[model samples]
Target: MKMIVGKGSCGIAAGANKVSDSAEQYIKDNNLDIDVSVTGCIGMCYLEPIVDFIRDDGTKTTYVLVNAENIKEIIDSELKGETLTKYEMPEVDKQRLEKQTRIALRNCGVINPEHIEEYIAKGGYKAIEKCVTEMTPEEVIEEIKVSGLAGRGGAGFPTWFKWNAARSAQGTKKYTICNADEGDPGAFMDRAVLEGDPHAVLEGMLIGAYAMGSDEGVIYVRAEYPLAIVRLNIAIKQAEEKGFLGDNIFGSNFSFRIRIKAGAGAFVCGEETALIASLEGERGMPRLKPPFPANKGYWQKPSNINNVETYANVAWIILNGGKAFSAMGTPNSKGTKVFALTGKIKKGGLVEIPMGATVKDVIFDIGGGIKEDRAFKAVQMGGPSGGCIPADLVDTLIDYKTLAATGAIMGSGGMVVMDETTCMVDMARFFLDFTCKESCGKCIHCRLGTKRMLEILTRITDGEGKDGDIELLESLALNIKSSALCGLGQTAPNPVLTTIRYFRNEYEDHIYKKKCTAHQCKNLVSYTIDADKCKGCTLCARNCPVGAISGTVKNPHVIDTDKCIKCGKCLSSCNFGAVIVD
Candidate 1:
């Protein structure tokens, strides 16, 4: 029997470690012969610490919201072949399962991440084995081409084209780089894959290295992801020990080695050129693109860079053949895309859905709808550099072409769902603020343009927006999108542009009426006392942090408008529902 505990970052955050320890203790205390192991996330983040119990008969039952307290009962019931219906998370319909295809995330939440043998046992390096033994370098590229696997790392560029370009390049020292430097604010899909299935990514890299005839592979990982780094280091050491890495891998004449290059948490480092510069021990910044990475990259040699998720998919495509993988998703965009569905959504975690799945299905069906049963407003896909998609367009198919056509890019798949309480103007301003700080300052449009746009958004959120502020924002967004050099700057205006396209009325209301429809912009709200319901409750007066409320023991409380800071402390303290924000 197999009893697995979720060990992803979200699971860890929800006390999965304690759950694991408790399960182990319970097993030992009960003298059970069950196998208790740790795995990655199962995407249901709302019911984290997800425990999966697989019986000897291969029937599996998943227990959601599993905590330390429930460990003993789960072990006794599930491990002992007893069913605990009370602990099981209700299974969704078959359509939801059919909509998802787990190619990149196949091994995730299935194997113990720290153990290399566990990964190997589950057909981990079969692709590299097939490639080294039977397939030639060009044949491997052709398989990827047939698979129609584009880069999952935001750009959606053809993966085989990148490999073929590097393979065709006239260079003695070509390079293969695994871009683990995922800098998107709400995106942890790459980090999860790296942490959970490092060997899968390494196997993909090995395949790429063999395909492109590259001898050296570098993993450009961000310093912030310590767990991923640790797991990656472990996987590298294990692979080298097993002769999967190092010279003449798998007895093949093709010699390859992989090294780790730590990034200093720079968002620009995710770009190919900037990642190359950082790997070269220089400051992370983007350069010109005409002489692209394929021709001249990474110490002026031919290089191919793909993000963690993209490389993770390579091994599967090689093993399963192209047609098997290509038949899953949309015609233009093939295969499953992993999204870190977060922000205001009920089930916020890693979700791997097929490319053609609509945004509505992702949000409502898989995500279990919005938190607190709030009305759906919009979803911000692609993180800070992405755009806001309105609730009306929820049925829009989520693919690279569809999102791009809607003036948004399928950025690293950070789907941040926003409810009715989220202010569109505030959302735009928040993302702009993030980008302004993360700007590499390589281009003036990204640096100054983002700052200016952030200022306008800030003014609008603060109720100081003028009639022309919206027009100014639109103009600046277009200029930035067109004039910027790198992707950071090029897509920096996405939030503003998409918000203006979808929630223009909210912007107009803020600019013209000086009111926040969502009541999110604190500056536009005023706290007042409803005299009829005050009941002379001095509790509000005493609890007022700013001393803005004053009243006698029996008389109705009144707020001194001039002195009130609109903090709403008295409102929360009042039991009679006297305080109101208008």
Candidate 2:
């Protein structure tokens, strides 16, 4: 029997290392002939610290939420040829990975990432082999065009369109760049791919370099992802030694090499021009794009740039054939998309579903619905640069056109779920604050405009808003979208604009009534004691950080409104649910 422990960032954070160490010790202590190994996250983050037990018969059983304490019992049961049913993954979570069409994440969590042989066993670099040996560069571009794969980084630009442009561009020196600097909040799809299946991304980059006629490539990944960088550096070295990368790859006339450039985690650098500027050692800011990267980029040479997910799908399209991928999704958006499911979701992890699947299908069927069974309020799509999609539109199809119609683009695939207790006005404020701080100050419209919008949102949530504030926000949003220098500033007002479009009443309530309906904004919330439910436990008083709650023993507790600070500790501490917020 062989045991493998998940060691991705999520797994490590959830104590998978401790579980692995204990399992290893138990195996050594018992003198068992079982093999122990490690791998990356398989997108089931909620069931993390996962342990996979494989029998000699080739059957694999996954144990979820494993820790140091419970691993010995599992090891003992396995040695005795007994089934440990309690540690097995739930049927619902089992269905999670089984349900999605995994092209990019095909090798993720299934193979040992540190070893290139495991990746090669899964037919990893065959795409580049086929591209160099079987098909021509133009033929590869044609295949991508037939596949209908777009830029998965939010903008739905055709993959082949950019490749062909860069290939045909009038430049002696050309470059291929992978935009792995994913800055969207709550988004970790790229990080997972890098940490779990770095070779797949490298293989995709290899094929892209061959297709784009580039001799050099750069993966501009974020510095925040230490594991991803470490794994990537390892993958590159392995690929180099295997001849899948570096001079005369696969013994062909073609030669391509890739380098890693660590970014400082700037949000504005997500834009191609700004990324190009950063690559040139300038401040990460956007420049006017008449010579869009294809014609002139990266040190003023012709370059092609795509996000990690977009390139990760390349080898799959090459192997599976373009028509096979194009048949899966709706008319416009083809193939599958990966989303980092987060916030109030039950199965909060990485989800890859077909493009046409309804939001309800992802959130309910796959995600297992909201946490604590709370009433669904809205989903913040596309990060701060995206919009809030309300519960009424949960059935909206997960396509670029459909999501864009609701004022939210299918961004880098960060789906933040919100419950009924979430204050939409305050939520808008929070996102605006992100965009405001992240602004690069390159263009006056984006620099001053987003700051002004954030100030307005702050005032509204702070109970100091006026009647024309909504109109003022709308006007600013429209102008910024039109006049801003780049995509970041243009899309900065998405949270504010979409909230006004769908949930204007929430903003109005914050301004006109000075009452937070969800009781989320601390400035607008009032804590009170419910006489009927309070048992004078003094638990609330003891837990209060500000000493807000006080009362006699065996009597109902009272919350001092002035000293309350509007913290909800009292509400959670009371066993009878005596504390109330209004």
Candidate 3:
């Protein structure tokens, strides 16, 4: 029998390492023959620190939220051939896993990532071997073209087209790069893949290198993902020792070598040219289009770059045949896409679903809807650069064309669900603030225009907005979208434009009525005591941080708005429902 503990970043954060150590110590002390190992996250992060016990017959039982305290009891129960129902995975989480199709993340939580043999047992590097031995580079490219796999990074461009471009381009020193610099605020699809199954990405990159006639590969990952980098370094070394990488791979003429380049966490470097520029030891910034990366990339040679998720799909498409992958999703978007489901969500973690599933399907069925059973208001897709889709559009299909039609791009698949309590105006301001700060300051339109828009948004949220502030913001957004040199500036105005398009009423309330309907903007929120409900128990008065509440015991209390500071302490501290926010 074997016991596997989750050790991904999320699992580690939840104290899975302590659980693993305790279980190992127990096995050592008891002289048990059970083997203990670790695996990456299983996408059901809500029930993290998950422990799995595999019997000799291959039957596996999963236990959620396992800690050092109860791990011994669970192991003891398993040894006695008895099931502990309390520690077992919940039925709702099981349903969450059953509803979706997982392709890119197939082996993520199933195998031990640090072990090369485990990855190989699951057919790890076979796709690259097949590519080098049986088929030519053209055949491999044709297979990918048939699969209809687009770039999962954000652009949704055809992957085969980029490979073909680099293959046919005039350059002996070509390159195949993996864009692991995932910088979207709520996005971690790439990071999870890199941490959980680094081999899948490496094998995919190896296949890409073979098809593009490139012997050199580089994974440009952000420095923030230290765990992923460490695991990747381990995978690279293992692959080299096993001949899956390096010269004369599979005993063929095609040879490839891969190295890692740690990025400085610049959001703009997600763009290809900017990433290449950063790799060239220059300031991370985007360049003009005539000499696109396909023709002139990374040291001015012909190069092909695809993000981590895009590369993760390569081996699958190669093995299962492209037609199988194209069988899923809408006509435009093929196969499944991974999304980081976060914000006011009950099951906040990695979610991979087929392309055509509705937002309702993901949020309601898989995500278990909004937290605290609050009214779902909006979901921000594509991070700071992507726009918001209001509650009315919850049924919108998840696809390239469908989401784009809703003013939101399927940008790296970040679904930030918002509830009714979230102020749309302030939410827009928050995203605009992120983009404004992340701007590389290359273009006057992005640098200055976003600054101006942010100022107007700040004024609106602070209750100093005027009637024409919305119009001014719209005009500036259009200008920046048209004039900005890169995707960063062009899409920076998305959150603002989308908020105005869907929730213009919220903007008007903040600007014209001088009120924040959701009571989220502190400058506009006011606290008052309900005269009838106030028991004057002194709890509110004593808990008030600034001595804002006043009254004797057993009498009606009053809130001094001047001293309240809008902290809402009295509201929470009051046992009775006396405090009201307006």
Which candidate number would show the highest lDDT if scored against the true structure? 3
Candidate 2 worst ten-residue window by lDDT: 74-83
Lowest summed lDDT across 10 adjacent residues in model 3 is found at 567-576
Per-model C-alpha RMSD: 2.0, 1.4, 0.9
Per-residue lDDT tens digits of candidate 2, residues 216-279?
Answer: 8999999999999999999999999988888887678899989999998799899999999888
* TM values, all candidates: 0.95, 0.98, 0.99
lDDT-best of 1 and 3: 3
Candidate 1 C-alpha lDDT tens digits along 289-381: 979999999889999999899999998998899988788789799988998889898867778988898999888887789999999999888
- Please report the TM-score between candidate 1 and the true structure: 0.95
After TM-score superposition, the amount by which residue 209's alpha carbon in candidate 1 deviates from its true location, in angstroms, is 0.9
| Global lDDT of each candidate | 0.87, 0.90, 0.93
Can you give the lDDT of residue 552 in candidate 3? 96
In candidate 2, residue 152 scores what lDDT? 92
Backbone clash count for every predicted candidate, in the order shown: 1, 0, 0
Q: Pick the candidate with the highest TM-score.
A: 3
Instruction: Report the lDDT of model 3 for residue 229.
Output: 98
Local accuracy of candidate 3 as per-residue lDDT tens digits, 484-569: 99999999999999999999999999988888989999999899999899887989899888888889999999988888899888
Q: Which pairs clash in the backbone of model 1?
A: 40-109
